[model samples]
Target: MHTTKRLTGAPGIYLLAANALVSTSAYALNTGTDLNLSMKPIAGGMAGAAYTNPQEVSAALFGNPATLTRFKSLHFELGAGLLEPNVDNTQTNDGYSHTSTSAARNYVVPDVAVSGEVLPGFVLAGGIGVDSGIGADYRTSPVNAGAGLGLGGAGAGGAATLPLVLELLSFSGNLGGAWEVTPDLSLGAALTVGFGLGQLGTTGSTTGLQGLSGNFGGTTSSVHNISLRGALGATYKVAPEWTLSTSIKSPLQYDYHSILSTTVNGYEQWQSVKVAQPLEVTWGVATDIVPNLLLEVDVAWKNWSSAALYQDIFQDQFLTMLGGQYTLDAWQFRAGYSYASSLLLNSPNGSLGGLDGVGTLPLNTAVPGVLARNDLTKVVQTTLAPVVWQNTLTVGLGYAFTQHFRLDGFGAYAFSENTSRSTLALGNYQVTASEWAIGAGANFSF
Candidate 1:
């Protein structure tokens, strides 16, 4: 993502394969690791709805810090988002087909939050953002550690290979307080400080890969870190126009370092991985029904088999979001929809059940990575972290211009997701993905 001559043995350990075994995994829009769902861009124009609809001050200090006591004074917001994903990975063996796209697409996510009235009804919050990153970009694809790895790198007298990179970038900072206990209940808490970066496997000379498929004889990989987490919330207002919410988050472990430096059967070995992020519970419902129409709904679970080194390919999942907003006076309009469900505990048709089959190739037996019952780690997790898009659609808008100032924007789309995997040790592997995004932000109050 290794060293090679048919890699040396057991499928030469898929030389530089499974790029960093999820070195920091995630390319989601709400499926795997959220890459900035909210932090305001006007809740990406409703699809993220900032929990109970709190748009400034760091999206309520991270979407639900008890709705930041409904903020009464001093506020500040700044945001920018521009994401792109149009991944296409095709690996055909018998007929030999190769295609690659995903130069990790373009990305930029930023946000700032500031709250005030630190004592009256109690509302203190802080913020920082740049939530997640790391999207695959098969470096021109043209390097085949052979025994049929068939990756590509269509070149033009240059960039011949030695780049394969799986990426991820994470950053966080919260700190919170919120309170209100009565006017209709409210409570909040926060304290997160995540920071993870990545660059899994391969470089100018091909390093290591196949985290569980074996042979990460890497020479040394990278996955830097700093994690610590927390989040708790509640909000009521039960009626008068409804509003009900809840939150809980506390899981984001990462212990990776020098993650690969392999050569294995030929010696050069080195490995490291820890990864975890689960235990997130959320529930929400908001309604305004008609004055200017506002609606929201959220549901999340994500327990992923208890979290640890990426919960063996994930299982306990559930996520759904639907949002709507419409105002008029100062102009506002938004829409949203999101869904997540598949992490396939059992091949949802991608086959790789690996009971004795599909394990051919020089794959020289290792299959240890994300252990979802090892079928060569599901053909190395559908060929390197295929988070398979579930569905997404969003729209956005906002403009205040005064009364304190405001401006928001949003746009999103994720539909096409193709996954076809068959392996008797590499026969058919097709991964197609699609995505789009646009964002904007600005706010100030006093």
Candidate 2:
């Protein structure tokens, strides 16, 4: 009821028809292949691991609240990014290979924020952006995947087809401020309202909903939800050339109304579900590696093993990021690298919870020979939403033309990675993913 009340107008309508998918494979695990693309709200040369040292206005606003005090005067930054993610899916069974490439590319990521001194000892900040997104499309595949989902080749012959189509995006808007606590230490916090929207469809196929025995696989569902979360951070200057900072972000949960369901005797039934993002803790440090060079490194941990939907097949994640900035008379150069451990640290082996309105049955103890009908569902899910990317490389540039204006640009590439899983239910499933993102922006400081 509360979610419906807030999402009733144009925003809801656009979310329903919005096809400009951002990036990733699943709701909880789609943190993107690069920092600027999904993990952070930054643009161009500012696209590095920055928390201890604020790279730009938007970075401090959304990254580390305590870092906001780094801005002595009014500073404004407006930037956007064009991202292209390439994903491929392949499933082989009984001498047939069904492969399709993701048609969802060219996503627009925005970064708009400002920070300024509202008082003599305190500073204020605000920003909004698309945090993370991921999706896949198999509708255009000529393979006519009809193996396990019913029709074409279900039980009549060779395995089944899984032309699943899915898209999910997480967005946020925030407002907060920081204080100059002493001369060397700063403390601040930020509160944000998070929004999650997504659609899962099998491209005209009826999926197994547990207890629905015949002609299954032709079902689709969409969910839109909102929740609250906040972050607390502190930054301290260790010396004239080094700074240290850390931030702790609370977990955000999105309650989906009727996101899953079953059917009975020609009628469809539905139930609610909740998928939550994990709590995150990060530590960063910046120091002058040389006279004109500044280096920053950030390390973080994500508690995915304790989250809702993520806990099923995901483990706690550990991530690391590194960046460098070089200053010349009127020009600056930047380079960054970021890596995140696989979210699928513990892969699911035909394990899933209960389908709403249906009884829960463990695959290891199900009526002896039925072979657990849910296995097909597990295969469908794994093939549809797999998280596999791990390494990202980036390079950036910055130029200051005057004391009040500056320009920045950057380019990044995510190396391709592949994985193959074998299960009796779906034979063999494979996924490969990589990405490219680039953008430019300008900043004004007064």
Candidate 3:
């Protein structure tokens, strides 16, 4: 028996290890009381509510200005934590193993904010803090030549491989104020700004293949922009032991100019893309059920129907065949059950999806020339899939060792399962992929 020998050039593989990093880097939602700590107030998963206590009230400045009136002295919150991510995947079809390690223990994030008593009934507060701007980091080497997979050769002549990697980082900060009207009502607002960075690159060649063999190409880019945002908060002592508090943070409209640069065959190319992030709204209520014990829940919505964060391109096909663009949209609902132990525990998660009628290229021509398109209906219609919807549950505990020092621990479970099936062109073959992730973090305040 004789086996045929295939000759091929190296293929480029695009492995993204940091697809979504926002939820993994931010605070876990719980009750209006917990919000006063280093993380965002209002428990569960939104950033637009105020705090329950005076110390935590300063932390609320990031969401509402009127919260400042609750503070009397100049106070500050300084802290940081480590993020550990665990990702896993199981593939079918001509599946391949393209897994990645973790970037845990990378850096200690910090929070800094100060509030002062300006006059009898007025107060001012402003500070800089770090919040998870995206989700976790991941790397999976797709097995399709169309994916530019650089591992082993599976071509006409041999196999082709394209080695690609992606890394990401993000952060944000805000400054604002609050005023007291009657002794029971307060009104306030603030301005928020943020920045993000990402790196993507590829290199390698197909070996012993037919008509395809070459060096690699690499590219990396970053984005820095400013957007304006504001909020309003109010509290009413409905009863002697019961207080009703509510707040709203205006959604932000951002115009970001991303700086992109690439190098192919030792030549460099540069370009810029402008994109938008939708406005988000959050509302919730907190009550002291008993002494030192509290309960709260909040809901949030993100208008992701704005724009595509990245563009898609397929060589060898007519540009006219491309379909309309798509964006992301979601809603987060959170409820908290807590115990004011030497530690605090809060769990929050929600469901979100993309809009309807969007289209995606499910199958490309391995034979070349035939184009197949599907309604992103799978991704748009299903709560999960073709498009990606992520749900997260968080558990946090806080312990105060002494009067001036305290510590908080957070463990989070975030799952993102995409349900659409599609293929791209590489050496006339189809390519497909799916993913899932988990993460944890901690903080100390003085």
lDDT of each: 0.61, 0.61, 0.34
Q: Show how many residue pairs clash in every candidate, following the order shown.
A: 31, 17, 61
lDDT of 2 by residue, 74-127 (tens): 898878777787887775655666666767678887777788899987999888
**Model 1 weakest 10-residue run by lDDT:** 22-31
Model 2, C-alpha of 274: deviation from truth (Å): 1.0
The full ranking of all candidates by TM-score, starting with the best, is: 2, 3, 1
- Candidate 1 per-residue lDDT over residues 1-446, each given as its tens digit: 22332333354333323331222111111114565354358777666756775656787787678888877698888887877877676655545565655577777888888887778788887888865564565545632222243333322221112344566677788888888878888888988898877555544433323323333222335668889888899989877789888888888776665554443444443445556667788888888868998888887787867776445555787878787888899988888888888764555212121111211122224434412224334434444566778888898999898989888888888788887655443345567777778888888889
TM-score of 2: 0.82
RMSD list, candidates in order: 16.8, 7.9, 13.9
In model 1, the Cα lDDT at residue 199 comes to 55
- The top-ranked prediction according to TM-score is 2
Show model 3 residue runs off by greater than 4 Å.
1-58, 89-107, 135-162, 201-216, 241-258, 261-269, 307-409, 415-420, 424-446
Q: Is candidate 1 or candidate 3 better by lDDT?
A: 1
TM-score of each: 0.33, 0.82, 0.58
Provide the lDDT at 347 for model 2. 47
